[model samples]
Structures are given as C-alpha cells and as structure tokens.
Target: MDFKGLWTTIKKNAIHLFKKARKAIKRYIRKLVKHTKAGDYSVLIYTIFALVALILIIVMFANIFSLGGKKKSTLDITTTEVATPADVTEDPQIAAQMALKQQAMDIYSRNKDFIFLVDENHPLAEGYSFEHHTLNCGLDIDKRIYNDFSEMLNACNMAGYEYNIINAYIDKATQTELYNSAVAHYVDQGLLEEEAQAQVGKSVDKPGCSEHETGLAIDLTDVEVLGEEDYKSTRGTDQWLMNNCHKYGFINRYPANKVSVTGVSDEQWQFRYVGREAAEFMAANNLSLEEFMELVQ
Candidate 1:
C-alpha cells in the first residue's frame, strides 16, 4: 500500500473542498447585503405597501363578517314581524277536517226527517229489499253505507236469518212528537218537567239533533223466532245483528253501557249509518260518536 501517496491525495481534496465552501458562503453573504442595502426607498415603499395590503385584507374580512351579521339579524327581524294571525291558529289539517264535519252537518240538517223507506223493488237490487217485513222502513243511507248494508243483508238472507226494517228517517215533527211522548211518560213517572225531559233524552236533542232526523239512521228488528222482541233481547238473530252491524256500516247508536256517553237509553234496535271503515273502527275502539267526531274533526 502506498500510504504517503494516499495521504497526499486526501490533503489535496480537503483543501479543494475548503475553497469551494468559502466561495459559496461569500456569494450568499453578498446577496443578503444587496437586499438589506438601506439607500433604496423602493424596497421601503414596497414593504409599506405590503403592510397596507395586509391591513386592507384584514379590514375587508371584518366588513364581510359585519355584513353577514347584519343579514342574519335582518332575517330574524323579518320572521318575527311577518308571522300572521292565521299562522298561529289551530293546525290547518285540523281546520280542514272540521270544515268537512261542518259540511256533513249541513247535509244532515237539510235532509232532516226525510224518510227513505226501503224500496223492495229497487232497480239496483233486482226486487229484493234488505228489509224482511212489508213495512220496509229505512233511511236513505249514504252510498257507501247502502252498499255495505245491502251486502250484509244479502249475506243474512243467504244464511236464513230474517232481518226487518221497522223505521227509518223521521222528520222534525216526528222527532218532537216522539220526544214529547217520552217526556210525558217520564212526567207520569213523577219527574219534573226539566228532570223528566233530561231523563228521557228529550232535552239534549231537539228534533234536529236526533240522528234519525238526519235521514241516516234506521231501526231494525230480527224476526227469526216468534214472540221474541228482537230489539229488547240480544239473543239469536238480535245477537247476530249486534255482532255484525259494524261490518255493515251500522252501529247500535244508543248501545248498552253507553247511556251516559250518548245521553240516551240503550236502543238495541236503533242503528246509525256511518261508513264501514268508520263504523268498524269506532266499534272496535269503543269510541262514541262524540269521541269519533273529536278524532276526525
């Protein structure tokens, strides 16, 4: 190994690197001095302009924030001032339902006491009346109710159970007369005028309040067995009616156990025509007409 030659080569390389490093450091110092020279006002002016630009950018951002805050405040003010009285009333959905109920009430009032006895020879029914007896009394049921009641009657006839319609719509005069008769009976039982009227359903309903007066109710009697009062007893054919009336869009209006709710006696014979869906829902839910009215209206 030529140790002396190797040492000489290393020494020469170290000197060369030292020169190169010194030159690079001098060049960097010169550049830094050139930028830092103080006689040039342009650099000072540029620095001042840059500082001003920064301040302007900050001011612009602040203005944007202030504008956004004002916009938000204006929106809140408008909302607070523009809300209307109608907007604060009861729900529109509820109002619409109440309007429908009012319409139904008007319709019922206009048709009060108009009897629609069952036409045994209706063209639509092919000469078969739903009623079993010759009296053939019934209300002019709503179209939907008529369809379901007709279907139910057809089914009952097919099953050999006899259904009869004893009465239907009664005008205001008839309702008043019936109510008066009841009041008289109660008065005979020793109740005072007001007390008797209240006890017998004569006071709460004037002629118009009775569903019967609306031409949307009917009184039915089952005649499967002889000497059996169908309306008074809930057995046999009467029981069938009680169980199945809801399916046919009819409900025992003054049903047993609902005297307090109805302000009337239980009339197993009396039925009111509601739509099938409504009848079934009311019966199943144990809802009285007033309760149903609350839900729907």
Candidate 2:
C-alpha cells in the first residue's frame, strides 16, 4: 500500500480498537454507578478510560511507525511488494509480464546500480554520478570494482557451478528503457499510469540513479541468457554461492529481512562487489549493503 493507504488502514484499525475499548469503559462505568458501596469513583472511572484510550493510540503509533528504534522515527515502507512467480499466476498476462520483470530485477539486483540513503533518515539519495567500465554481456561496471569482481567470477567458476554475466553495465538511455518497460508492465496489469510509474520506480530505478551506472556491480546467473536457466534446478545449490560470494568481495545485495532498509526486494541470485573487507563484514553480520554502510559511516 502507498503511504496514504497505509495511514487509512492504520486509522481504520485504530478507530476500531478505540471504539471497542470505549465500549468496555462504558460497561465498567455502568458497573461502578450501579454499585451501592462505591464513593465518588465516577471521576476515577473516566480517568481510567482516558488513560486506556491514550495508551492504545500511543501503542498503535509505535507499532506502525516504530517509535522506539534509535534509527527509525517512521517506517521505511514502499507501496510495491517484490513480485514473485506465485504472485502472478492468476493473470497469465501478468505472469508472463512478471517473468520479464523478474529478469529485470535480477539484473537490477546484480548489476543494477542504485542509490543508497545519504543519511540515517533517507533510504534514497537525491543524486549520483558514476564512472564505469565495459564488462561482459555489454555491461559496464564501476572501474574500481573490476579486479575483485573478476576474481569473484573466477572463483565461482572454479567451484563447479559456473556463473555468467547476465548484465553488468547499463547506460542512462538503456536504464530508462528498462524503467519505462517496467512502468508499462504494471500499467498492463491495470494500474493507472501514475501508480504504475510509482510502482515501477521501486522495482526499477530511474535513469542516472541506477547501480549499473556505478559499474561496481554485476548480475550473475548460472545461464547466460534470460530464458535459459532452470531456476528450480539451481535453487538447492544457491546457498553455496551465497555463503562463498563474500570471500571474493561480493555480497547478496538485497538480502532477506532487509527490504525495509534497502528499498528493494531480496534476490538470491544477485551479488554486489564491495571489496573484500566490507563484503566479509556484511556477510558475517547478515547486513544489507545499506545497513553495512550505515554502521561504517
């Protein structure tokens, strides 16, 4: 749900809870007034009711917004959910579309350059500039990450499960093409253009802001082309790579339980090369790239 929709849901639930509590309060007040032995406890009964209502409201706000976390004042939520194959089967058209979208996310997850939050409160940076190098599959990656990236791929190949570059470098124009295509895919799913674009923006980055532009990343898969891989067959063995990818200076960029922090979905097949030191630390701690950056900064 979008921000407004979430608020509406919270408000709706809160009001429902409040009303239920109010009814209980009234029942208690009725009991108090009915009791012959009671003194002037009407004021006390009403005060208790007020405290209960206030506590419920406070708890509601805290649960939804995470009031007590040192790092989070408000929840870092996006309207989009990471679409899975199971999510689209009912609509074959959307299923087919989601299949393609999944490919894009894999690309984005692997080599798709993205913005990291500039501060504790930001999950997205307002701007970025990148210098990159040409890599396999016509992909461009940030020049600095090349040696570790190459070493990582080499090590993966040596391990018997060969990994190939699906996409590495994406220029502004090409990235825009991917983003526009994602927007259209959602529109085809029946979302209005405005909402479709907003939805797509979360799954795919806009031009100049993508991680592929940074060239420090890559999207690797067992197969070279989009449609060739047997995803089911490879599923059982993915962890070996996940566990070892860090040694070569790569980390599963969007890891499980970190969608809230990274503003992206988890992708098991995607890895981001962050030099060995940072990569090892992140993997050891199960930290998302964003979280790792936060701790270091």
Candidate 3:
C-alpha cells in the first residue's frame, strides 16, 4: 500500500485500540471502587495490576506502529532513482573520442615530468640541468629522448628527405647572445633599445625562457632552403618534417596560426620533444604546448 494509505490505516487501528483501552480502564476503576466499598482489598490490588498491564500493552503497540511508519518512509527515500547525464547510452563516436582521450591521459601521466612547459611566460628554473646525448651532427638533446629523436632522423633519411639540424640545446649564455643580436638588428634600424627588445621578443625568446635550454628543442631546415630569407617557409624537408614529426614524439613548437597564443612567430623548422602520445594528441587537436597544458589541467 502507499505510505499515506498505510499511515491512515495505522492511525485508525491505533484510535480503536485507545478507545478499547480507555473503556477497560473505566471498568477497572469502577470495580476497584466497588471492591474498596465492600472491604475486599485483594480485588483492588488485582484491578490495579490489570490496569498497569493494559497501559503497557497500549504503549508497546504505539511504539511498533511509529517505528513501522518511519522505516517505510526511509525505504521510499533510499531506493528512489534519479536520472543523470551519465546514465544515457554513449554514442559510438563519443565513446571512441573518450577512449582516445583516456589513452592520451595514460601516456601523459607516465611522462608528465618530462613534458613540461618552457616559453616566454614559463621560464626554466635556475640551475636546471639534464642528462644529454650529443648527436653525430654535434647537436645535443635530452638523453631520455635521444632514442626517439634518433629514430625520427633515421625515418626522415629513409624517406629520402635531406635536412640539416640548425640549432639545439643552447646554454643560457648562448641564448642571451642570440637574443641580444636580434635586438641589436632591430636597434640598428633606429628603434630604441626597449622598442627593439619588444620587437625582438616576438621571435627570439629571452635567455632562460628558450625551450632549447631544456635540451628538448631542435631547429631544422631543408638543405636547399637553409639560406632563404624566409626561414619560416615549409618547403621540401620542412614540409615532410611538419607533416610527420608527431609520429616520433616531436611537435612543431610554433605553428603559423598559433603565433598569438605562443607569443612567438612561427618557425616551421622548430620542433620540440613532448613524447609520442602527447605529440599525437597535440597534433590531432591542433594544440600548441601552451594550449595542451591548459587542456590537460
């Protein structure tokens, strides 16, 4: 029965029991008075005991009904089901997307320490150092990622793409010099030192802020396109590298479209190692390092 109907029934039964109890008490009182008047003290004692037992029975029934009602109410509340967004059957496309994201997260969790951010806004900590392996081309990269980098270069060679490593793993002093030189070039054009620095900042990251300081960034160029005025052009080897770098745990650190977000102009040759899974995730989503960091967080 519904809670309200059951409660009504219990109330009616309780009222009937109370009425009967009251009638019995009244009868006992009358008997007690009669027995006292007749000088029968034993009958008076028996009537008093009977009245006490009847009251105890009434109290026990009241407690049982009260407890029953409470338990019913509690059961109704506890067993009630509430629908939510998560309960719906997931779409196949969405499920596949979620699986990919979970896979990326698993990869990220295993390599989060190595997949760090270093940009104009996020500088490397002072005294930062890493075990590094120098490539046969004389460029050094973080030792932990050497195998992946080597594999990538081997793949590029096998694909018949001719390229040269222009820069990698710059020390703070060298980065400072590069920064100063860029600023000097702008200053020679009659811009004030501060203005020149501001202009240069868009292209050259200031000293400690450079990703090369972490030994995980590399700059490359097609052998034919190395001396071009527009180094940002993705011709020949640059095109191949940009298209396939993610497969080997590298990302084009600065894409032309993400200039505003990265706070640096695009260098099509610039690539950074962020591990295979992260690179693939970023590539798939068209995310820069800054954007990827925000997304995972």
Candidate 4:
C-alpha cells in the first residue's frame, strides 16, 4: 500500500489501542464503583485518580490522531462533554475513548502526519520516575537497580561470556540524534523526507518518547560493542541472561512473539527493568511489558 493507505491502516490500529485502554479503564472502574456507590469517603481519591487517568488517555490519543490539523468532531464532542470528573462516571467508555481516533500508528511511533511528534505532555516522561544507576559496564541505569542487573552481568561473566552495555538511559538529545540519523538513512535509501521521518518514527521513538530516557531500558550484547552490523553479527546468546534475567527483575522488553502488541520489532538484546515481582509475573504469563502495564497499572 501507499503512504496514505499505510497511514490509514496505522490509524486503524491505533484506534484499537485506544479501545483497549478504554476497556481496561472501564473494567477498573467497575470494581471501584461499588465502594463509590456506598459513599466510601476514602475511595473518592481513587475515583478522582481514575478520572484523571481517563483524561490523560483521551488527551494523549487526541494529540496522536488529530495532529494532522484535521478537525475531529468526535474528539471535540467527547472533550466538551467530559468537562469534569463528574462526567467520567456518566459514560465511562465514551468518556475514556472520546478522544482516541480510529488509528493505531502502533504507539511504537505514531503514523499520522501530525502524530509524528511525541506527546511530551503525556503522563509518562522518559525515565522521569526512575533513579539513575551507574553500572560497571560503563553505562548508567536507574539507581538502586545496579545490584540486580550486576548479578545478571556477573552470571554472564562466570559463564565465560562477556557482555556489553550497548546503550542505556539516553536523553532526549541523543534520541533526537538517533532519530535524525535513521531518517537520513531512510532518505539515502530513496524515501521522501516525510516518509523517512515516519519510518524513523516506527523504530526510533520521538526524542522525549523513548523508554530508554528513564534509565530502566538497556540494550546489551554478548560481545564487544560493535556497530549495529557488528552488534547484530556478534550477538552471542548468553542463555544465562535470557532465561534467568527475569529472576533478577528484567524482561525482554520487546520479544519477537509480542511484536503485534509492542508495535516494534523484536530485539532480543533489549531489556527493561520492571522489578522482580512484576518481571516474574510477566514472564510467567508470557506477557510483554506493555500488556503487563495495562493489566496492573
């Protein structure tokens, strides 16, 4: 398909994401409503938080789908109606999704012309919640995680394998550099600049949108840090790390099997620190970080 057709497909998929979020939120509220109906004074705060969460979802999706400057009447109406917390309970699903358009752009990176930019205003800031940790591999991760991660590294070393921290905790500027470089590469391959930018979006998340900014995500290798070519070629498998990393609180952030939900290609070397408890749960259930997050939080 052409760009427009490809974009339409992307948008359609993005809409599915919004729907998924809407349903999940609705399910959460259903459990809380009983306490709310009984007027449990303490539950009021949770109610407010849920409403705020709904608003964040709406606003984020609105920016993603409507970035092209097209006047989306559905979102406009939905935003208008849900003016306050009171409106969320009135029509949970509609209020939840009134803002997300019928598109998926695979939140990997939005496909819409307007959504090409990252929603810097979205609830999660790149690594805003994680503390910094300096690892001996010459890379820094979220603080306090060094112990668990180091144990994983040490296990690899003991196995007569060496590991390299390919990248960890990139800042927005570095993300911009990677993004621009990817776009340039695509352009060199003969794609139009705009298409190249979108293609870049598919892989290199917008500067402020990358999870690596949080220091919880890391790209590693079993051999010396080589260029992507070398990294790919020398990507020796340290089964000790893969099978046992989750025991220490990391998971393959984007596994090949979950590409449909993650919207990114599999990177066996990429891992994210979700904590041991959550990691175990995720691994046990065969869930991706995205799915686990949707369910638990």
Candidate 5:
C-alpha cells in the first residue's frame, strides 16, 4: 500500500553510503602519501645504480691506462739487435783496414804456400819458449792456440805435463814449398803431380782454403814429456783446450765427427778462434762456420 515511500527512503540511504565510501578512499590516499614522504625507496634504488655505474667507469679507465703503459715499455725494448759480421764489414763507420788486414795476411801466407819462417825476421819467430815444447806426438800447433797457451804451458810445468808448440805460423812461401814437396812425395808414391798438390791445400786459394791462414787455427805436437805411452790416446792438456777453449773464443774446429763437413780429418790437435760467443754458439750447436753462416742468413 506504501511501496513508493519505502523506495524513496532506500534511495536516500544509498546516497549516504556512497558519500561515506568516497571519504574513506580519500583518507587511505592521504595515509599512502604520508608513508611515501617518510622514506621513498626509489631514491635508494637510483643511488645504488649510480654507484655501480661510477665504479665500472673507474675500473675501465684504470685498465686503459695500464695497457698504454705496457705498450710504451715494449716499444723501448724492441730497439737493439747485435751487428753481424757482414754488417760490421759493410758499415762505413768501421775501418776497412781492421777488416782487411787479417784477411790480407791470411791470403798472402796461403799464396806463398805456408812456409813459416822460424828465423828472427818472421812475425811469429820470437816469443817465450817453454820448458815443454811439444804436444800430441807430431801435432805441431802454435803456442797461441790456448786461451793463454803460454800461461797454460807454465801451469803444465807445474802439473808435470810437457806442453809444446810443434809448429806455429807457416808463411805463404813455406806453404807453397810444403805443397810442392808434398806433391813430389805423392808423385813418387804414384799419384799425378796436380792430383797430389790438390790433395794438400794450395797456396793459390783456388782449391783448399787454409784455416791456418786465419792465424786463429793451430796444430799441436809432443804433448807428453817422457814419451808417455798414452800420449796420443790419453786425455792431455788438449782436453782442457777442448772443454774450456770456447771461453777464450777458440773451438775444436775440426772435431772428430765434423771431418766430413770440414773436408779435413778429425784434428784433435787443431783449434780455431772465432771468438767466445761465436765459438760457444757453434760448438754448442755442433755447427761449422759454413753451417753457421747459413743459419745467420
């Protein structure tokens, strides 16, 4: 009977409820603002990111400068390599006489055929004559072969080993005479004169190159003082020469196994001075001068 009035009352109540709901939402919004103002986590997150980026930048800059410093150091060290023999020979700074004199003497002596003058006038004629004057039986190498072969001789006297210089420098004339004589001997033994001469190194420098002409090469003889039984076979002062000679720039040039490479026999008595570093390098590697030259190339 009063349904319309009841509907109007319900509508009024619903409007009041909507107002209350809106006020309640506004209060919660205010509360959220207050909590955010107290402390915002967003600032902390941004600070952390910034700090990480700063650290990365510093690390990168440090790496770049470190690499640059190393590059500069490496460049400085790459500048110096030792000069080779050919380089020294060709350099205008080095005097030609220094290079040519040794070669000239070597060539002249070879052409004259290794006739070493034992007389006073010869360059190598006079020096100290030791009490012991021979080594390795008939091997007549010079006194200069050892580092201080003379000093070694003195030591030998102290050690009771008889050291000697059976032969020293053979001049060009002497070499030629020796060659001719060897040739004659070969002919008498039934070989042709030219063939016999060819067997021995010629003073002309056409066939056999004389290592002796270098003045660095030498042969030894009569090493034993009292005609000792093991003179040739036993280890004598020459063993000291073989083991320590490289320190003084000499090598057992014609080593036993290297005969085929050197075109000469295993000359236990022969030694050649190529200088310490070169000799050590050669002997250590078992290389001949020709082989070493190739390696240098």
Candidate 6:
C-alpha cells in the first residue's frame, strides 16, 4: 500500500479540520464577547469551556494520526527488500562463478592432506607416484592440479603477463643430473669434491629431495627477462605470478623473506601447487610450506 500517500492525505485533512475549528472558535469568541457586554457572563464561560474541549479533541486526533503514520513508515523501512544470497544467485553469471568457486573449495577440502612438502629435509618418498598430464608446452605436471595450473597461466595470459615454464616434473634421474652438474660447476671453480658437494647442496636439492620430483612444482620466468642477472628484481611475469598465483592454488614455494624457514634461497620463479585452501591460507599469513605444515599438523 502507498502509506506515504495515505499519511499525506491524513495530514492534509487534519490541517483542514484545524483551520475550520479555528474559524469556528473565533466566531464563538466574538459571540461570547457580545454576550458578556450584555451581562450574560455564564454563556461566555460555557463557550470558553467548549472551545477548550474542542481544542483537546483536535489535538488528541492529531496525535493518534501522527503516531499511526510514523508506525507505518517504520514498518515500511524495516520491510525493505535487501539482497540475500538467493537474490544474488539469480544472476546466471554470478551463479556460475559461485558454483565454480564451491567446486574448487570442495576439491581443496578433499585433497587437503595432499600438500606434501618436499625439501632437503623432507625428501620425496621412494617410488612416489602421481598421474601426469603433459601440457601443450611439453611440460608435465600432476594430473590433479593440471586444471588449476592451466587456469592460472591462462589468467596470466589474459592479464597480458606472459611467462614461460622453465621446468616442471623432473624425475629422480633428471634431479640427480642437475645436482651433479651444479656440484661439478663448483668443483670446476677449484673447490674439493666434498666442498663442492656441500656448496651445491646449499643451492640445489639432491635428487629425490627436490620439489620438482613431486610433479606439483613449476618454475616460471618471463622470456624477456629470462637470462637477466637480477630478473627476479624486475616487475615482470614472475612478479605477477608471485603476487597472484595463490588464487589458483599455487604459492611462491621459496619466498625471499622466508629463506631461513625454508632452508632455500629465494627463487621467485618457483611455485608449488598446494590446493586452494592451503595456498590461500599460506599466502595470506605469509607462511612457508614448512610453517604451514607445522601449524596444520
């Protein structure tokens, strides 16, 4: 109902009634003045009493109408249509996005325990197996995380942040080769074998101890800045990935500030998929995988 209009009409009628009553009271007072002049003071007294009663009645009616109108206004305000989840779900695009988010959350919940941290101390288990899916770029990753990884790269591309996957899914033999090569590089610098191995261990993971062995880590870099000495310091694809990868279930596995906790030097290009829930929590709380695992465990 149009309560405002009804209230306006009531107000107008009250004003009109007040105006009419005022004119009648004026006429009665004038008549009482003439009666008093003719010595009929009793008539004047009664007229004065009637005028007071009439004013009281008008004031009582005005108060009742005003209170009723105010209550109706309050009711209208309280019952105003506010958007609820159901209302928001009415939009098809929003509903679809919400469904996708829920689906991702469900997947994360189911695989919450799959966030295995592979580092020097926590090496990949013997005969560790995972289904692999090869991307068009000829890099293989864990099949379970392919969708999230692809979506993340796709989002990066959409945002015009181009990147190249430098490495992913290195088998134990490949990890061994890389580790030996790093050690050799140090040895060629005139260091003893033992000293070279120790130095290499500081930078490179030894075989099964590498996160790449899990098929859940990827190294990303911008083609434009690939060989730059301080590529990580530049604002490029890697930086963008580091800032936003968590939204797609990835985290900067070796953040520069957390080197002490991770026992690895900062590698801004490296990201590890730990599922959305864990990834987001780690990102938000600025936690390394080691710290996050400790908290959850």
Off-target runs (Cα >4 Å) in candidate 2 are 1-131, 188-190, 224-237
Candidate 4, residue 206: Cα displacement in angstroms equals 1.1
Instruction: Give the least accurate 10-residue stretch of model 4, judged by summed lDDT.
Output: 108-117
Candidate 2 per-residue lDDT over residues 1-297, each given as its tens digit: 499999999999999999999999799777766663467766676777999999999989978665466443234234225665555685788776556445434433453343243222442344455666677556777777777777766776677666667667666679779988998998999999999988765557776666665565566666533542444324423555677878877877765567787766534456777666556656666777775544434
Candidate lDDT values, in order: 0.62, 0.64, 0.84, 0.68, 0.55, 0.82
For candidate 2, what is the TM-score?
Answer: 0.51
Pairing residues by index, what is the TM-score of model 1? 0.47
Better of 2 and 4 by lDDT: 4
Tens-digit lDDT string for candidate 5 (4-98): 99999999999999999999978866765665688865655665698899999999998898887845465545642556675576666565545
User: Please, what is the TM-score per model?
Assistant: 0.47, 0.51, 0.64, 0.53, 0.49, 0.61
Give the runs in model 4 whose Cα sits over 4 Å from its true position.
1-123, 126-130, 187-191, 224-236
Clashes of each: 2, 13, 0, 15, 29, 0
Candidate 1 stretches greater than 4 Å from native: 1-144, 184-196, 202-205, 224-230
2 or 3, greater by TM-score: 3
User: Of models 4 and 5, which has the larger lDDT?
Assistant: 4
Which predicted model would earn the best lDDT?
Answer: 3
Worst 10 residues of 2 by lDDT: 115-124
Q: Which model, 1 or 5, shows the larger TM-score?
A: 5
Kindly provide the TM-score of model 6 when superposed on the true structure, using C-alpha atoms. 0.61
What is the alpha-carbon lDDT for the whole of candidate 3? 0.84
Name the lDDT value of residue 171 in candidate 6: 92
Error of 1 at 118 (Å): 22
